[model samples]
Target: MSILETTASILKLMVERQGAIRISDVIHHLGMPKSTASRVMSQLESYGYLEKDEIHGTFLPGPLIMSASHLVNRQLTLNDHVDAALRSLCERTGYTGYISMLDNQEILVLRVIHGRQSLPVVTWPGSRSPAWGTSTGRALLARFTDTQLHDFFASPQVVSQLTGSQQDVSMLVATVARTRDAGYATAVNESVADTASVSCAVGDPATHDAVAFCLSFPQQLATPEELQRIATLLKEAALTIAGKTGDTQVSSPL
Candidate 1:
């Protein structure tokens, strides 16, 4: 990797670990000469991307990191709105709720709410779930171009469920097609056993990225009629969230 890329990789590692890393550690991770790593570290330090604690002799994220992240998280209000929306959805529906957005190749859970009655499902905040295997992921996948969809299907991350309900790209694509036609997506025990969810995309008002609001319930509790009503609520809530959040794209779900 180029020096710049290497520096960025190092920065990402440190941020993920949330721990101080020494110069020797950086060299060991990168498998580069000490002199090269030292040069890269010096440049990063000069650029205010990293700071070394003199006493510990280890580097940590510098002020610039927080400033840049603040600008990003500030723009989406991702953290702020996610928790509020999740809580409101769970309260309204009496089911677990979550909001997710496509982050790179993964669907990232921004917030989650567990309702009063405990369900068998296991989920958490800031969790990363596969976009190819869940209803929320399929909601976004339906909107991708043919080439993008093909590329995503080719990736190894996509997996077939043991439930024997749906398998292969054709079936998944067909499901997305139906979701696009219906203006929402639903999966019954697709991700977790005995748990189902319905989701609708939260279109960005500005850049038009596909975001989603999801409601999850026990398989027995989520009847067809209930799902139909929940679908309406989810659609309306997603649009409301987008409008209130100043999302850029005004396009409704298809």
Candidate 2:
């Protein structure tokens, strides 16, 4: 098939599917070569037509696709004040910072700022990661109620991603509970190996457009005190970002 056909097919799949879309799905569904599928999908992502989950390499609708899919007449604003906040977080902590929103059981990255270190922990604007495993995800997941949390854990993606019989939901519950009490979340080697991150969920959890702020670095480089300090900074940035977005859901730690 021609490039047009491939693009249309991928778009159709994204529009119809409710979950994350990986390149393997495109290869499996379209019988296209891996190179071709990756190229087309990458182009779509670069053009804001498709977004890859940075952590899991899953694909989802990009801002353009989402706007059209949702009947948004205006050009979807991807970043504004949030970019500055992400940059500031990076400068303050010398860790890569992220601005993201809850997308079902994942976090959709809107922006990322690499730290002063030469090795940038880079991820695309539209990439996604499972909520159960990442600092940003856990921070947001902490907002879920008992019923919501239980139902969230039941998702195939969540259950499958969790190791061991820990699908018991109790483990996830405890993690979220800690995030709730602390007003931030931390993860080590959860998504990307050797990476440690601190995150805070900002915005109203009840709102479908909830957002989170995160900072990540190499696990070995972080001490307990440093991570805690970063978390406090992240919470402050979260509050600032949430205030800018008019989302007043973030609360102080217990």
Candidate 3:
């Protein structure tokens, strides 16, 4: 692999481990030379993207690298603020509210607020939903490479089960394309009857991996205009959250 790819891979591995990572570990995990891994670590440390603990002698992602992902781990854990936002959304929309992120090919619910209009939101905190059948899933797809998206669409593994709706691959691609243009994704009565959702991808342009954040409501109470409005609101909220958490350069549809 190229030097840049190797460095990026090392950084990803360090983040995944969530703690001080040793150069040896990166070398072993990536099958790269120890000297090359050490050099990468040195460069990352010089850029303030990784730091060495004197006591541990291991490297951990520094504040800068954390900011690149919008400090997603930190921001998502801000319980008080997220709760207030969820409560506000529920009050304004008269429907349940939720925040979620993409994990592989699944949507992982991070928070939820129960309102009068509640469905079988089997998705709970730390739980996941398939990425192909939901609005949040489509939004996440907006961040994939064109090649990756095309391959995913062509792959037989792309699951689609919205009853009486376009479950074909072409339809899925078109939907994602529209989502990319609109800066959000929407699903109506697809995951659940009379349910609606709008989602946008939160990501670091440098990493090219999407961390989607979304809001959902009941379809009965949501109009097309309202969905658009909600999408705008969701995008604004995501930007605010991203700014506060340090992810400032999220790719924009505009």
Candidate 4:
């Protein structure tokens, strides 16, 4: 691979780990010669893309990378709207609500709003969950074309992990189809046992940048009718956010 590509990969690894990484860890993980890895590390450190801890002899993301991330986040106007929608959903349903998006084959939680309940599901921003094992993941995945689904299932990031009744790609495809048909997705004891959730996709499908709005509650607390009601509320919130963002192409599950 090109030097630039290698450097970017290393940076991504550091970001994913969210902590300092040793030079040896990079060399071992990337399978690069010690000299080559050292050269790359030096270059990144010099350019302020990485910072080394002198005492621990480990590297971490530097100001430059953080600044770039901050700038990009600032430009994401949709986050503001999504956050407001999450709060509104939580208030209406008395259930914890979240926004998630697919990132590197994982479902990355972007924002969360706690409801009136005392014992809401505990998931933090920046936490990731298996894409095939959660309501939000299924909701987002339902938007993928057949070819994209195949490619995603073939990737190394997607393992043999099964959630709910999905044992193979065919079952996963069927689940996506059901999610599309229902205008939402549901996960009961899939990601976290005894937890139930329903989610709907929001944003323009053409941009391939949709996010899922989800309502999570204790399984025992959610009757069949309550689940359906929460799903309706989630869909409405998603549509409102999509409309505000001028994403008229969002598929209507209704």
Candidate 5:
């Protein structure tokens, strides 16, 4: 889509929903770059077309959307579809489901569903966490090719933005490679001490709309074999969610 078309599409997505939206939402829906989404959103905010919620990290309709005669069209909100998928998975598996999306080097929790077992670590909707340590983060990162992964993690910043080459990209790439081989990703004592998670990436990484379906709980809840079974279910849900979000090009489930 052209820049104008892209901007219009994102704005439409924002106005169509009653709630706020994040840059990650625009990326997921439109397959736009983080830089581009930021730029467009900045422009919209400056023009009074959008308002930012600093605390919640979301965007809402601004003065222009409130008063202008701009066209409002219906489009499937990608985050909505993912959130629903997470809910269904949590119901079936009895595990909390997190709908997470990549926003640069961080993974943002877009939705959260509570299962029977409460997580030892707190994860709230719209919370931002490290992509390097969490299964949800690694699952989304696994979408990148090795070279892309290296470039993505070139900087060792806690945020992991491509800056000074201080990060252990090799190790991250190794973990990602394992995710590629296993058709899923897992974490133990990485995101939070004594917490574990299993994750699967949804849709194509090339789309720039990277998302992951993850189930997190206390570390001792499952053994390797049991975790595999849950991972199987998570992978299936992630795959189905790709089609639901209108992104049929998904990460390989095989």
Candidate 6:
């Protein structure tokens, strides 16, 4: 292959794996001369397309590549819609609002909107929590099929590392069922001690990916009335999101 083709292939590998790539691995995979591969890697690093670990002698995607990836992902996903909804929810409730979705067995926060409160609950994009312990997690999990749920709980090692009190598989199954029936989910001092959250799933079950919108507050501060209001507002916001996405199955709460 030409030098340009070789460089492109190497960069593709780095982007796809999202981890460090060793020079030897690149050489073995690409069948390029050591000298040519080193030259290409050095040039790419100089331009900030790749970063090298001095200690491990491995190369990883650099700031420029990651930024490009982020831009592409933001454009491809429902990031803008979810971000706008979270902001509006935060404004309406004066509590921290966030969008989270299941990532494997964990809940990954995609966006967060800090409330106007002086001591708002702090959360950041890309943060992860236990799937079985957070309101958002449960809300999205409620959409999983029985077989999918069984497969998720089949791995004890995965379940053991989850953040809250250890729960039985039967208990988790029951929780999912309840969440499905309730049209929303609640977690009080579960994922994080002293924190309370309520969430509802967004988008159509068949068309779009499982996602949830959540609002969180101090456990001691969340009153029954406040919780109910938040749940109602979350459902409304979720419906709006589903509508915007052209999901016709808007009859379901989740």
Best by lDDT: 4
lDDT of 3 by residue, 49-125 (tens): 88888787798777786676565554454334445555776687666666666665567777767767666554567
**True-structure RMSD for candidate 6:** 15.3
Model 2 agreement with the true structure over 1-254: per-residue lDDT tens digits: 88778788887676446368899999998888999888888998999988888999998878887777455213222244456677877887678877888776777887778887533246678998777777888888887787888888888777776757345567778988988888899987767777888887755422345667788888887789988888778777766655444454564632
Off by over 4 Å in 1: 1-79, 159-166, 205-210, 244-254
Candidate 5 lDDT trough over 10 residues, lowest sum? 69-78
Candidate 4 worst ten-residue window by lDDT: 159-168
RMSD (Cα, Å) of candidate 4? 17.0
User: Which is better, 1 or 4, measured by TM-score?
Assistant: 4
| lDDT of residue 24 for candidate 3 | 83
Clashing residue pairs in candidate 1 are 202-211, 204-249, 205-247, 205-248, 205-249, 206-248, 206-249
Tens digits of per-residue lDDT, candidate 1, 170-223, equal 877788778767767898887778998998776544445556778888898778
- The clash count for each model shown is 7, 2, 0, 0, 1, 0
What TM-score fits each model? 0.60, 0.61, 0.57, 0.64, 0.62, 0.63
**Which sections of candidate 2 miss by over 4 Å?**
1-79, 118-121, 163-168, 204-208, 244-246
The global Cα lDDT (0 to 1) of model 6 is 0.77
* Pairs with backbone N, CA or C atoms under 3 Å apart (clashes), candidate 2: 52-127, 53-128
lDDT of 4 by residue, 36-110 (tens): 889989999999888889999999878897788567545666667677778877887688888899999999998
- Report the candidate with higher TM-score, 1 versus 5: 5
| Two-way lDDT contest, 1 vs 2, winner | 2
Per-residue C-alpha lDDT of model 6 across residues 4-76, encoded as one tens digit per residue: 7876899767644545898887888878789988988998889888899999999987889778866754564
